[model samples]
Target: MYSLKKELLKKHYKGDNKSVEYIFNRLTDYCGKPVRYNMSEEEPDYKWDFYNSLFFVITVVSTIGYGNLAPTTSFTRIFMIFYALIGIPINGIIMVTLGEYFGKSF
Candidate 1:
């Protein structure tokens, strides 16, 4: 299993040193082994992180529009509009509840 994994990694990397190192580091991290490479060389990809997703959802629901990560395609834009239409009221209720709770606490 270990040799197969190593072979697959080598084939996937195809001799690109940077990609090899990146995959090696990720594998090591997943396996709880000590990482041998400095992780700062690569910029982190946050396309699906929690904060980005929450920000996107909040912007859509609040009608505040998008920032740098807005949808670029027509289909996605249409979907987002429908989603906002459905979600805005729900989000409003949530915000109002939170606001009231905080107001009472303070």
Candidate 2:
């Protein structure tokens, strides 16, 4: 049981880390920035600013679907479809495994 739990945690962190890296890379590639950080730059505000984009990614992987912010461009939208396809399940598994571990401990 301990070994199984350890494996689950290992897989979860690995996948989650990859997902986060992908989100950050995508945001940077798309020039997303936080709302507050926008003042420092002379560029137009994007729909998926850094903070909002991070929130968006978290909401997506966690299946929250807040519907507040979203990808505007077709490319980004398409990319998100694929991203979610892979990320959501990994995150769900992680949450469930962690919950089970804690529940068992308690």
Candidate 3:
């Protein structure tokens, strides 16, 4: 990939030796940096398993929305709209009920 890109860059910038060299260096820098950083890459595990999926739905229902999570497919996005509409109100009711119970107890 680097060699092919370099060859294309050389042809594209045929007479401009200075700009070609500068861009070549930048390209190689990008190619090298990924190796050093790959270890820190995050796993896409959210909403993949049952427990995490439950937490993701809870986050949505409770309105702490989008903690770096989102539904990507068209159907999922549409479903989430209806889910949140129904869920948020139910969650609010549950929260108010819990608060009233605790308020009387305390």
The digit string of per-residue lDDT tens for model 2 on 1-106 reads 3343344445554556665455445445555533221213344556656887788889999888987667779998999999999999999899899999999999
Per-residue error for 35 in candidate 2, Å, reads 18
The candidate with the higher lDDT, 1 or 2, is 1
Residue 42 miss distance in model 1 (angstroms): 19
- The CA lDDT of each predicted structure is 0.74, 0.68, 0.74
- Top candidate on TM-score is 3
lDDT of 1: 0.74
| All models, RMSD in angstroms | 11.4, 20.9, 9.9
Q: What is the Cα root-mean-square deviation between model 2 and the actual structure?
A: 20.9
Give the poorly placed runs of model 1, Cα more than 4 Å off: 1-46, 104-106
Model 1, position 89: C-alpha lDDT score: 89
Q: How well does each candidate superpose onto the true structure, as a TM-score? A: 0.45, 0.52, 0.58
lDDT of 3 by residue, 10-70 (tens): 5666667676666656666867632221223454455478877888899999999756678
lDDT of 2 at 57: 89
Off by over 4 Å in 3: 1-36, 39-47
Sort order, lDDT high to low? 1, 3, 2
Error of 2 at 45 (Å): 4.4
Model 1, residue 40: distance off in Å is 23
